[model samples]
Target: MRPPDNRRRRFEELYQANHDPVLGYVVRRTANGHDAADILAETFMTAWRRLDDVPAGEKARPWLFGVARRALANHHRGERRHTALTARLASELSAIQRQPREESADMDALAKAFEDLSDGYREVLSLADWEGMSIAEIAVVLGCSANAVRIRLHRARRRLARALSVDPPGRAARARVPEGDSA
Candidate 1:
């Protein structure tokens, strides 16, 4: 029972115990087997590095799942950025194009508000609302306490609501112009 000897055996046991389930989790969510394998490998790599951090018992599975969830998110984010870059390049290269459709003013305002949110607030909201993850699940992914996740979620929702309720900048400025003084 030394640093790595103890750690290695424990990790081997963990990997043997959970590898199939972890693989299945990733494979179910990912589009391709290759990507699933990659994520699975990365997940185990993280577990290897943080072997001491894995929970002592049943919580280990959920903890690994959380790590896999983050790896998947990172993969998707990278894919989306790549796709956006490709689309932008295509749009620039195209000589002829129809005028872009106008989004609703409300949608424009909402998008601006979302963009203005801090990364932590946006991530918390996305995990809670967009991903439909429970508070416990989010806490696992974020490596925080359930109470912390709950508090963060509450604050994020309040911030989003406040952001959504704010008037568009132009309208707010117009409202500030004292009646006749249209400066």
Candidate 2:
């Protein structure tokens, strides 16, 4: 049973005789070629390790088929576990992505409404609100006096606030109140 040269010779004979049948058995059970290849390797590895357990003659092929079947089952179980983990991670990722976006929907509406404003109003409001520019800086950019920039900024803000007032909150801010309905 512990004779090294004899053991190797027997395993080699068994492998030569049964490699194709065992591979075909595993390949038919698994979807992926790689999985089939791996299961085949594992089956042969098991046969080599348990050489004494392997039967002689025609019985040896059935014994190898049984080993391949079990290897294929183990491979399928591992695939199921991997698939379940990916799905759980995707669910968690989508939940995280949605939370911030839900909070920003109102901002999306505000930006949409802002787009409909006259260029002057948009410029003045963007400078004051988004760019964090001072009246002096805005006047220089607009080529207007500081007092004029102040007046334009104030008017732009009032107009924006009035525009927003008509918009139902938590809806697309892009919707416009008809000029007739601006009351």
Candidate 3:
């Protein structure tokens, strides 16, 4: 079915008069022919929807161009949103891929050495390193003086350092592995 003849004719007249100028306006401001065509179509659709708002004669050209300009701006905003989403997704994916590789043999050896520490050394070290507790805070947790917690923390670090020196983290796993061999 067709629109009433008058409405169809009015739309055709409007399109015929303003289409080339609107196309040129969109094309000059757009990145490519495809985007220009899309914006141009949207401009005409807006004009068709708001035919009563469109002016006559010389004013009509500027009015159509304004619609085209707004259409181009909407296209650019959508593109920016898409680009931002893509960048965010790529960063999240890279973080996920990099996490497992960080859980390597060095950390395993360090864990074993940490577990072998005596209870007192483990308590102080775990508070200071793992739990990120300050000496005063560790003292509160362990019911001791801050000065005592500090001394215990120092001795705990020394013991862990000596253990690591004897069986250095990553040394046994990485040593003698041939280049380009994953095993």
| Cα lDDT tens digits for candidate 2, 1-183 | 466898999999999999998888888888888888899999999999899999999999999998988888888888999999999989986865677876667666677778878999999988987789999999999999999998887777776766767533334556657877863
lDDT of each: 0.86, 0.86, 0.85
Q: Candidates ranked by TM-score, best first?
A: 3, 2, 1
For model 2, name the residue pairs that clash. Answer: none
Q: What's model 2's overall lDDT?
A: 0.86
In order of lDDT, best first, we have 1, 2, 3
Report the Cα lDDT for residue 171, model 1.
49
The positional error of residue 158 in candidate 1, measured at the CA in angstroms, is 53
TM-scores, each model vs. reference: 0.49, 0.52, 0.53
Model 3 steric clash total: 0
Task: Let me know the TM-score candidate 2 reaches against the reference structure.
Answer: 0.52
Residue-level lDDT of model 3, residues 40-136, one tens digit each, is 8899999888988989778999999888878888999999999999999999878666777666556667888899999999999888887898889
Question: Model 1 has how many clashing residue pairs?
Answer: 0
Q: Using TM-score as the measure, name the better of candidate 1 and candidate 3.
A: 3
What TM-score does prediction 3 earn?
A: 0.53
Output candidate 3 Cα RMSD: 20.0
